[model samples]
Target: MDKNKNHVSIWCIVSLTSIPLIMTLGNSMLIPVLPILEDKVGITSFQSSMIITSYSVAAIFLIPVAGYLSDRFGRKVVILPSLILALIGGLIAGFASWKMDDPYTMIIIGRIIQGIGAAGAMPIVLPLVGDLYQDDDEKISSTLGIIETSNTFGKVLSPILGSVFAAILWFLPFFSISALSLISIALIFFFVKVPKDKDEPLKFKQFIRNTKEVFKDEGRWLYTVFLNGVLVMLILFSMLFFLSENLEKVHDIKGIKKGFVLAIPLLLLCISSYISGRKIKGDLSRIKKIIVVSLIAMSISIVFVGYTSKKLILLLIVTSIVGIAIGALLPALDTIITDNIRKELRGTVSSFYSSARFIGVAAGPPIMSLVMKNYLNISYITAGILGLILLLFVFKFIKVDEIGKSKEPA
Candidate 1:
C-alpha cells in the first residue's frame, strides 16, 4: 500500500463521486427531455426510448469485458481511456441532439459510445476503491459505504439538477455530463494513485477462467441476488418512466413541472440513503433482512404507483416508498459485493454485477413501454412478478452470513 497516499482528498472523492454522477445524471436528466425528442423528432415511443436504451445496451454487452480489462491492465489505464470516451461520446450526442434534424439515430450511436465509456468507468470504480485502500479494512468498509451514498446521491440529485439545467436549456444536461466526465478524468490523473497490481499478466484464456472462478465461490450467489436487486431497481425506474410518460401524454405536463413530478420519488431516495449510511455497522443477517424488506417495499410501491395513476397523492406517496427502498438496497448490495469478493478479483466481479444491472436497465424500458402502450396494468403486474421472483431467489441463493469469512484480518 502507498502510505504516502492521502486517503481523504477532496479531489479523490470528487473523482470517485464523478463516476456515478456521470453514469446517473445523463439518464435522470434525459427523462424529462425524452418527451421533447418525441415531440420534435416525430419518433415512435420505442424509438424515443432508444436514446436511453442504447447506452445500457452497450453497457450490458461490454461492462464485463471492461471490468476484466481494468483488472488486468491497471485501474487507471482502463478508467482514463473510459473518461475520454465518455467526453467524446457526450460531446457528439450533445452536438447531434443540437444539430441533426433526424437526431435519434445519431444520438443512439453517440449513446452507445457513451455507454461503452461508462461501462469502463462504473463497474471499475468500486473495485478501484477496494484496490486503492487494500490494507485498511475499516477504511475500505467506510469508503464502500460512502461510494454507495454517492451513487444514490447521484440518482437523487441528478434529475433535479438536470431539471434545473434543462429549464435553462434542453441541451444543458449533455454538456453537464461531458463536463463531469472531464473532471473525473482530471481527478484520477492527479490525486488517486493506487499502485498497480503485480499479478501474472492476464491472458485471454485466463480471463475466461477467472470469470468462471467468481461464480464458484459460495458467496457469489449473494452477488447474483444483488444483480436481481438491481433488476428490481430497473423495474422501479421503468414504472417511473411509464408514469412520467403518462403524465405528459395523458395529463398534459411539459418541461420543468414535468421534471419535478418525476423527481419526487428521488427525494425519498435521498432521505433514505442518508439514513442507511448511518446504520452501516450492523451484522450481515440484519443487513440481508433490510435488503429483503426493502425489495418487498419497492415491489409494493411499484404496484401502488401503477394503480394510482389517477390519484396523484397516492402516486407520490408510493413513489417515495419506492425511492426509500432503492436508497437502502443499493448500498447494501455494494457492500455485499465488495466485502465478499477477493481484492484482486473485485473489479471483475463488480463488472459482472454491473453487466447484470445494465442488462436490466437496457431491457426494462422498451419492454415496459411496449406493455403500457397496449395494456398498462401488465406493466405493474410485471414489476410485481419480478419482485416476487427476486424474493424467491434471495431465499434460494444468497448466503449473506458466510460472506464475511472472506474478509482479510484487521
Candidate 2:
C-alpha cells in the first residue's frame, strides 16, 4: 500500500467526527431532563429512565444488521439513510410534545425510531475509520482517540445543552436534537468519501464460516475486549445516571446548574481520552498496561463513591477519577479490535463489539434506578467488583503479540 494513499483528508475528519458527536447529543442530552420529565409529564422515576433505555434497546437489536449491510454495500450508503431516519424520529417526538396534551407515549415511540437510526450511524464509524487508513496503525489509533474524544466531548456538552433548551420548554431538547441531526446529515452526505467496496459479498453460510474462523483463532483476546467494552460503557452510563438523579434529589440542583455539575467529570473524561488515544499508538503492550492500571483506579474510585455520598465535592472528585479511568480504557479497546481485524470482516466484527457496548448503555440507567431505590451503596460496590473481574480477564487472557497475527483457523 502506498503511504501517500493513507493520508487522511480534512473533510474526512470533519464528516466522520460529526457522527459520534451527534449520536451522543441525541442520547445523553436526555439525562439532565429526567427529573423535569417526572413533573411535566407525570411519569415515575423508572419511567423517566425508559426515555434513555428505549433508544438504546432499538439500537442494540438493529446495529448488527446495519453492520452487515455496510459490509455488503458501503459505509456512506448505509449512514446517510440512518441519519435521515434519526431526524424524522426527532421531529416526531418534538411535534408531539409541542401539540399534544400528554405526549409521553409518543415521545417513547419517537425515541425508538431514533435508536433504530442510531444503530446504523455511530456503530459503523470504527470500521469506516479502519477502512480510511488501512495501512497506517498510528493514524488509526490517533483517529480512534479523536473519535472517542468527540464522543466524550458530546457528553460534556449534552447536559448543558439539554438544560438550556429545557429551561425554555420541557420539549425543546427534542427539537434541538432534530436540528443537529439535519446538519450532520448534510455534512456526511457532501464531504465523507468512503472508498468503494470491490470484494464479492459472501453467502450467508460462507460468511458465518468466516466469522467463526476469525473468532476461533482470535477469540482468546477478542472476546475479552468485547466484554470489557460492555463493562466500560455499563459503568460509565450507570454512574452518570446515578449522579444526575442524586444532584437533583439530594442537593436541590436542577436545570443548567445541574448540567454544569454533570459536565465536571465528563470534561475530565474527554481530556483523558484524547491523551490516551494518542499515546497508545498501536502498541499492544501499552494498551495492556493502561487497561490494568485504569481498571484498578476505577474500582477504587467507585468504591469510594459508595462511602462519600454525603460530601458532594468528595463524590465529584471520585467520579472524576472514574471518568479518567474509563477515558483511558476506551481507546485502548478500540485500538485492539480495529488493529486486529481483517479489513473485509472489520465492519461486522466491530459492529458486534459495538452492539455489546450498546447493551450496557441500554441497561445502565434502569439498573441504576432500581439500585438507587433499594440501596445506593450496592450500585457502587457492584461496579467495583465488575471492574476487578474485567481486570482479571485482561491479565489472564489478553496477549499483546498474539493479536493481529496469523490467518483464521480453518
Candidate 3:
C-alpha cells in the first residue's frame, strides 16, 4: 500500500465527508421545521411538503446530466461550482424565511437551486473519491463509509438543531445550513484535488452512443440493485416525515425535544453505517445476499413503526433496525454498482444511481402522506409491500452470480 494511498489526510477525508453532511443537513434540518413553516409561512401541509420535493425534483432532472458533464468536463469543475450554488441557495432560502416574510415560494426556489447544486456536489463526490483511490478497493469503501457517516451524522443532528433553532427563531435553521455551505465551499477549494480521466472527452452525440453501448449489455442485477437503493431512500424519507410529524402532534413534543426524537433513527443509522462499511463483502454474490436481508429488515422495521402507538422506546427500536438496514444497504449496494461500471463512465453511472435515489426522495413523503391520510395503516403496509416486491424482483430478474463479474462496456 502506498503510504500516501491510505493517507488521504483526516482533514481531506473530513472535507470530502462534509459535502454530504452539508447536503443531508439541508434535508434533515427541514423535517422538524416543516410544521413550524406551515404555521409561519401560512401554507397548507402540501405546500410545505413541496419544500422537500423541490430539492429532489431538481436532483432527479439534473444529476444524470451533471454526472455526464463531470465525466467529460472533470469532477472539480462540477463540484466547486455546485458548492457555490449550494451556498447561494442557502442564502436565498435563509433570507426569504428571515427578512422577506413571504410565502414558501421563495424558499422553494432556493431549494430548487440547492437541488441543482446538489446534483453536482453529492453524486460527483463518490466518483471523485474513486478517481483518487483507483487501486485500493478497501480504502475507497472506507472513504465512502466516512462520507456516508458524515451524511447520516448530519441527518442525526439536523432535526435536533432545527428544533432548537425553531425555539429561538423559525429561520435559524436555514441560516445554520447556510453557514455550513459557506464553510464547505471554502474547504473544497482548499483541499480537494480533481483527477483527470485519460480517455477522450465525450461529446453529446458520442455520450449517447456510449450510453447505448452500455445499455445493450447492462446487467439485470444492476437495475434490481438500483431500484432497491431507490426504495430504501423512499422508505427512509417516509420514516423521517412520519416520525417528525407524529412526535410534534401526537406526542406533543416541541423544540429540541421534538428534534431529539427525530434524531433517534439518524443516530442509529450513523452507528450502523460505520459497522456496515467495514464489514462489506467484496464478492458480489455475498453482497447480494446482504442486500436481500437488509431489504427485509428495512420492511419489517418500517411496518413496525406504523403499527406502534405513542411509545417512544418501541419507535426507537424500530428506527434503529431501519438504520441498520440502511447502513448496510448503501455502501454495499454502491460498491456493487461501482465495481460493475467502467471507470471511464463512473460519474455518469453514479449520477444515474443518485437520480434513482432522488426520485425516491421526491416521491416518498408526499405519497406516504397521501396514503396515511386515506388509511392510517397504509403507509407501513405500502412500504412493506414495496420492500417485498423489491426483494422478489431481485430474485426473479437478476442472476445472483452475474453482478460485478464483467465491466460494463461504454
What are the per-model numbers of colliding residue pairs?
0, 0, 0
Backbone clashes, candidate 1 = 0
| 1-410: candidate 3 lDDT, tens digit per residue | 56665356666777888899999988778988999998999987677778888988998999998999888888878988898888788788889988886747889999999999889899988887778877577777777777777878888988888888888988877778778888987888888765555678877897777766665556466677679878888888877887877887778887788888778778888887877667663555666777788889988778888677478788788888998889778877777666566666778987888899888889877876676655657777778898989989877866655544435441
lDDT of 2 by residue, 299-361 (tens): 878888767766899989999999999898889988888878887778888888988888889
Score residue 58 of candidate 2 by CA lDDT: 97
| True-vs-predicted CA distance for residue 156, candidate 1, Å | 2.7
Candidates sorted by lDDT, descending order? Answer: 2, 3, 1
Scored by Cα lDDT, where does model 1 land? 0.73
Which segments of candidate 2 are over 4 A away from where they belong?
Answer: 1-3, 406-410
RMSD of each: 2.8, 1.4, 2.0
The candidate scoring highest on TM-score is 2
Instruction: Return the number of clashes found in candidate 3.
Output: 0
Between 1 and 3, whose TM-score is larger?
3
- What lDDT tens digits, residue by residue, belong to model 1 across residues 280-318? 553467567767888788776677666777777787787
lDDT of 1 at 2: 65
Candidates by TM-score, descending order: 2, 3, 1
